[model samples]
Target: MDHDHVRDVDPAVADALEGELERQRSTLQMIASENHVSRAVVDAQGSVLTNKYAEGYPGSRYYGGCEYADEVEQLAIDRAAELFGAEHVNVQPHSGTQANQAVYFAMLEPGDRILSLDLTHGGHLSHGHPANFVGQLYEVEQYEVDAETGYIDYDGLEEQAAEFDPDIVVSGYSAYPRDIDWERIQDVADDVDALHLADIAHITGLVAAGVHSSPVGIADFVTGSTHKTIRAGRGGIVMCDEEYADDVDAAVFPGGQGGPLMHNVAGKAVGFEEALQPEFEEYAEQTVANAKALGETLADEGFSLVSGGTDNHLVLVDLRESHPDTSGGDAEVALEEAGIVLNGNTVPGETRSAFDPSGIRAGTPALTTRGFDEDDCRKVGELIARVIDAPDDEAVKAEVREEVEALCAANPLYEDD
Candidate 1:
């Protein structure tokens, strides 16, 4: 963890790196889409592989001196295939958004119609949000979760697909807490003769560990982030049946990106190898259990959860009913002051702006990574409730900050460093 080399070159950048390391060690990271990667993975990501420029897949690279780069990239692709049981896996895209872009580039042309879940109801920007390039390039329509149950309205989605006759139907989500019915969505797409793209960016680890349903075989295309619950380094993956392998590989390379980030591919290979071990399964299970405990505790404290509770590693808390005067943005700032870090998210029927939404989404992947259990998460939940109840009270914030410090001490992160 010592950045002596960086310090020798640039003291300011070294100081900033050290500051961020300290910040993560001190604060609780509850952001659902994040996790702490292992030191091995970090080392691999920061390896000499960063100097290589392997442009094409495995053996057919556009650059020379790519022998080690080919080995690392092949290991990543093979490990990912084994982890997800995917017929084909492309580990080149820089991020989850690019993974989705690869699918679109392989399958659809500009102006093709897309059907996806609404963002406020737990969808992502790459699924055709107005601000993204996909939205401008394609004709997009969105579906929503049921108003009463806080789950996907499958019947409604089918009806919409029939009406819109879209070229591609996108499934999966970002903030929604419940498990998805991938088969049902796939069937709807089948009926419309549309391609199914399931973006499992948030729950890739859960799906890989068999805790949640997978879309690798059911959907025509499956995309995910390598980091999140998977605890890999920062990157993206695309999976599909072998029939679409060439199209996907081509799209990910020359279509969207030039040379691959070989350092990240090495990180992915190391992380995937780690995940193949038995303990990673235990970690994945504990992560979901901790989320359930957190949601139950929050509900007991009168916070309204989006789906009443969670089945995965995240809980979406709708703050409108519990604290009528407080906005999610307000709660976010207050909780961060108390050393708990998570994001303000939008709810199903959002009345507020997306920037300062009405809900907060908390997850247990990072907490569980730090060896937190159900009891610890419940205590964290209680701490969150206290801060939301008295967001402006300096006394309450100081008390909560002290407790957070104690928790961090008990569950030390990067202790060797």
Candidate 2:
């Protein structure tokens, strides 16, 4: 991870880069939408492709000197298509938000109706939060997870879709933990003659590995972040049937962005190649297993889990029931001090502000990438429970920090450094 070239050019930026690497090595990154990419992916993202500008798809570039860029981009596309069984893949959007934007741009016009999950109920801002451009552009109506069950109410959504008569229906989620019934959502869209866009940004790898059901074939459009559970470098991807391939490609390129980030495309290619290995399936399985173990441990410690459990790599713990006085932010701060890192998130039926929510969201992707298993995750959960239960206790914080350090040592990340 040495940045000798960057150090020679700008020592300050180099120090920050090295510091970030150190921070990741030391902390437990349980942020639900994040994961650690392999060193190979890192290397590819740091390659010479960053200097190239390929503004169009392979075989049809707007610039010269795109032969290598074409190769890398094509590799990414091929690997991703095979991974998800998508008829078409556009690995060009700069981020997950942009991926969603591409879908909207391709399918809908200004003021067209968009039906999506409510942000506080585990949906993404890009889906239609007032703060985002999509919300400003589209007439948005939001659905919600069941207050009592913490799952999507499909029948309710169907009824809402019929009433709203939206131009597009967005499925998949950001913070919700259970497996989605893509077909149910798609059926709702179909009945209303609306387009279905499934944003699997958080579970790209899980879907690819068959641990979660995919929306590639069922939904009209599918988009995801490459960096999350997929373990690619930072980027986004869009998949659709051949019928909409040109539209998606155009939307991702001239509609939303100019040149493709070829370096990130290279990283995506390498990571997707790694995911095609037999071991990655085991990794996906272990990731879900670890989440279950962590959630169970938290449940045993009196923490109320959303949905009472998880079917994926993430678990959302609502603190309102057990620790009425402590906000999710309060627990987040204390846990970080103890070397455990995760975010405070808005839970279903949230009674607090988004800035300081009632629940903490944890995920197993990064820890699993660092070789953590069910036992290790359970131990981490125990540490989390301790901190949340006694956030002001210095003695408990110290003990938990020591244990976190031991776990980090046991599963070393980037040891070459």
Candidate 3:
């Protein structure tokens, strides 16, 4: 869409870009946290709003000439608030992690206890990773999904809540593949006199489209990424109860970040407005359907799925029986050779290092956005099976890559308008 920039790119770079586009059009993108937004979102992200320096909210910016920037940002906040049914929204935090940071600053003190799902058990890094500020400043206790069923243990969580008496109970996941029973977590938080938060970063689009349950009313604070299923620009939002509105606003501005990314905010506004359309609901539903189909097909091919399978848009493949000598590390490389890009993830009790694990995570949002569905997803499963069956054979990888190209030709990304 930004033709001038594309033209300025070196010839090799341009060719590589074209090739990448071809690959994206062809292969399956089953990464749950990735999606394809419309040209409107792209345009707004590249707009002149990026030049502004609006340090504060509309009608009260820290700098002048932010009149239009303030208008667009406020519209984004209002639209997102309406979409998620939240009483307050802040479309500032540069990423989901920062959104969490602002919430912590607004509500809790340092060293407050935070009860969250364990990272390997489907929790995100910012929730309580030792390397992150969260683990350094707060007392962190983790809850786990039932190893056998791969689901949350509400009873166990309540017991821990009673024992830990944490100050915050955060309900969310990066890869559990099950719907969160946020109401139960809310109850546990209330019994323990803790604030409840939901990090709905991965499922915000599904939540917005009404295909999945939302935590707007259930949790006191909700954090999410605009780029994930929300299909917005690369940024984050923090939504909360009306009572915490000022606290959240001040925390984001003076307490955490400064000089907001006005261009990204404009893009978020366009993305939120697009999300409010009826077609967006259809897109979310289709993405879930594609994910389910892909998961079932892969399972039928004798690949064991982590947590059985996903209830949402991602599936984690356990590569034990398929490649006993290799981890998801090797499998991911093999798949990449075939033009499929996804990340290897650590499944529960994984013995391998964090960089190279036993499981590969895949999802459907991007491919579904490109209009691929059940039939196309099944074919991708077959291709993945082929690649896994011969992870080291260059010929096999090349052959599957060709197949991927053919499949992509059938469903090009961004069909000509």
Stretch of 10 with least lDDT, candidate 2: 18-27
Q: All models: lDDT?
A: 0.94, 0.94, 0.86
TM-scores, each model vs. reference:
0.99, 0.99, 0.95
Q: What tens-digit string does per-residue lDDT give for candidate 3 at 1-417?
A: 324477586767777777766656667666668887788887899889878899988899878888798799889999998899889999988999999989888888999999998887789998988989999999999988776676788999999999999999998778877777889899999999999989999988999999888888999999999988888888999999889999999999989999999889988999999899999999889878877888899899989887787777888887775667878888888898898877788777667877888888888888888788889888888888888888989999999989888777787777773
Candidate 1 least-lDDT 10 residues: 146-155
Off by over 4 Å in 3: 6-23
Among residues 3 or more apart in sequence or in different chains, the pairs in candidate 2 whose N, CA or C atoms overlap within 3 Å are: none
RMSD to the true structure for each prediction, in A, is: 0.6, 0.8, 1.8
Which stretches of model 1 miss by more than 4 angstroms?
none
Residue 362 deviation, candidate 3, in Å? Answer: 0.6
Q: Give the TM-score of candidate 2.
A: 0.99
lDDT tens readout by residue for model 2, 1-417:
798999999999999999988888888999988898888998999999999988988999999999999999999999999999999999999999999999999999999999999999999999999999999999999999998999999999999999999999999899999999999999999999999999999999999999999998999999999998998889999999999998888888899999988999999999999999999999999999999999999999999999999999999999999999999999999999999999999999999999999999999999999999999999999999999999999999999999999999999998877
